[model samples]
Target: MKKIWQLGFLLTMAFVLLVGCNQSETQKLSTGKSEKTTQTTDKTATYPMTVKDALGNEVEFKEEPKKIVSLIPSNTEILFALGLDDKIVGVSDNDDYPKAATKKEKVGDMEFNVEKVLSLKPDVVFAHESSAKMVESGLQQLKDAGITVFVVKNAASFEETYDTIKQLGQITNQPQKADQIVAGMKVKVKEVQDKVANVKQRTAFVETSGEPEIYTAGKGTFMQEIFDLANIKNVVDDQSGWFKIDPEQIVKRNPDTIIVMEDEKYFPNIVEKVKQRQGFDSITAVKNNAVVKVDQNLTARTGPRLAEGLEEVAKAVYPEAFK
Candidate 1:
């Protein structure tokens, strides 16, 4: 009887140990699943979110936007970068990047088509602060039609541009993608800055247009910020904003470099054109053939490519440093 009781006790103890092992394994799997769920939740934006737009108007989002319309090229570029191309049912006429945007429905250029946008039946419309006043009545028309319109800020600097991207990401349920885009931009910007950190600072003139009236970027403009990042001094830094400057003033400044932001498609041989300008022949940039033509879209559009623009400007200004 003693031997039988001892054996029974041993059997009971073994059964209890086996049950405990099974429970331990089950708990581990449960914990892993819980962790994965939390991670996913953290990456997604919650709906019924009300956020203030650049115009200070409170825009409420009830659910993830399935259909989107971008009224500006910069906004369209941001949307495409966030992998929301499928959701973009309409884009402004000016949106020509990503090659895919051109295939989307065309809204009017500076003057967006309210009827066309309505026809698309977008869940959200991304307008720009720059054209808000110009399209006020039209935007109100869309609002009256019970459509959600969010006026994105005109991003004048890199930081503002990053914020614009993040805001778009939040509304589209692409917060993770936005963060990733911004982080990548920041890294590329830093890399360019570090590359030119030790280079000699050169004076440059950024010409937005050439011929009839010369338009150059000055203080408080996006190109000014690009100049600052690339370690190049803007000869017209004293002037505020973009305006027509006398060609003689450029002669007086005699910048070490002349960076032209004209599209080759519209203005072929733009660099040569700059060199051929009257009295510009004596300029230092023309003498040294330092006139460089950069992609206007890359530098002008405050989008993901702005970092690439910075690198181009930096390399143009200091080619030796990059080499």
Candidate 2:
């Protein structure tokens, strides 16, 4: 069943790319005279700027996009970290990190309200790659209305995430700030890496959501990379991306620790559920009660705060390292 779903998702990915292609064709207006590639130079970004976005689409900005709308929390966090708070005209309903973001006009939930986004009259809108599949028509409508929208790709690793952050900084005229943020992240991650180097690696079972669906992060996902940094081995590392796991399989693997990435409120009770599940009772993590809680946003969102997430994972997986 998981294989079938994975295959379907791969096929769907092709269609999603095509959606971006179609939008690119419609929205790829001339960015004005092409200038030399000075992305490496330390200077204020010049406009009529043109850059290729995560979706492999060439997006042009006549000038620095001031009235910006971010349709995702990750992008919103990056923008705020770059000190573009005054320029952020609107944000998604899920944008809650900066607290100031909460004061911004709410466009909509994950599936953004096209009407609300347009009413905000943003010069540029930051979108997620999933929007290609989830709100293709709304995205098309936004493109047709002459609005510039850049759909950020789903970063599978931390390196890719850093590149996206740099890309955002370039387009938003904050390249220097982006570099500083990435540097800080690297320093923090290095601190955790150095501390966990001597610890014995533990096999971990990481749960992304509550049961019934029973999803866990697999190979090629950000979670797996974070686990690796923490000197923890994922039980489901053999699979790719998020995949469903059967209780029997989990018991067979018998992970040494279970890390729950949901709200803390779900703990103890969810821990009980894991213990009650047939075949899961005999699992080492269940018998030893080694379940730990991690914030969902830290592990999930691939933004500036990802370094903090990596540190949290290291602590959760190996509490002794922190002490």
Candidate 3:
């Protein structure tokens, strides 16, 4: 599958660079010193992220990994958020956020250039389950060569995501900092939930992509899950993953609320375009001001800022609940 290759390219490119960090041990500063963290605002974030990689070897970095590499886009975002941006030496070719991320080097897409990753010499590499097999195949040799690696469970739910974030804090030796970040996120999540918990059920459609007319993200995806969290009913809850779709089906569905994750550069215009489609004129979302635009990066990727993304989804799906 194209996505599998894409997944491979993104993950490997992300993994190689971070794990390439020099094995030369760095002295651990006594208990209160902060590791490399992002300087934006005073928001401190840290986390533990050690666990066996798919290769069956234990990996750990004692003093906050000074040179880090993030294979997953979501993990890349989390690293940045945890005030660990400076430590990140390389990122997946797809990791884009905080605008500044674009300035960093990209190893390659899914089937990232392993050679390039080896050169960066990262202190640690962050990876997850989706690419575990590929990561294992590629890194087993690298492990024999002696590189510390860790595998993070790519969590499905928001709660699991929180736990993962906390885990990241602990592994990175910034438990207190990481806890503070999660605490702040919890406040925002609860705020969003409280705002929409009592709203009426809104039928929403989350657009995935289109070519042979593909559309997906139903009952199991993080997108649909977010809707359920907001108490909104997904019109395509029966579908699984992202699938091929047509406007005719959408028009017939006539969902009450519509959520579009992709547009021309995250613009709100797609909502209007979907509304203009044939038959959709009769749909409630098009008739009312129920059409909402969501940024793909914010909603689609499972990461630390996911709570913020959920808040956006919740607000779009249920405005009255928030107000």
Indicate which candidate wins on lDDT: 1
Q: Give the TM-score of candidate 3.
A: 0.78
Off by over 4 Å in 2: 1-32, 38-42, 263-268
lDDT (CA) per prediction:
0.79, 0.76, 0.64
- Summing lDDT over every window of 10 consecutive residues in candidate 3, give the lowest-scoring window: 21-30
Clashes of each: 0, 0, 34
lDDT (tens digit, per residue) of candidate 3 on 1-323: 54444433333433342222212111122223453433222233233323343344445455567787777787777777778867788887777786667778787665566666678887777776667676666555444556556776656566656666656665565556666777888898788877877666678887744333445566556666677767788888876645557888888888888777654543346667777777878988888978787776676566767778888888787776666
Q: What's the distance in Å from true for residue 263, model 3?
A: 5.2
TM-score: model 2 vs. ground truth: 0.86
| Candidate 3 all-Cα RMSD | 8.2
Instruction: Report RMSD (Å) for each prediction in the order shown.
Output: 21.9, 5.5, 8.2
lDDT of 2 by residue, 187-263 (tens): 99999999999998889988865666676777666677788888899998887766678767888889999887644
lDDT of 1 at 260: 88
Candidate 1 C-alpha lDDT tens digits along 1-323: 33232223222322322222111000000121232211211366766666677778867777889999999888999999999989999998778899999999998877789999999999999997767887899999999998999998766578767777877877788879988998999999999999999887999998766667677877767777788988999999997767678999999999999998765665689898889988999998899989998887787677999999999999888988889
- Regions of candidate 1 where Cα sits further than 4 Å from its true position: 1-42
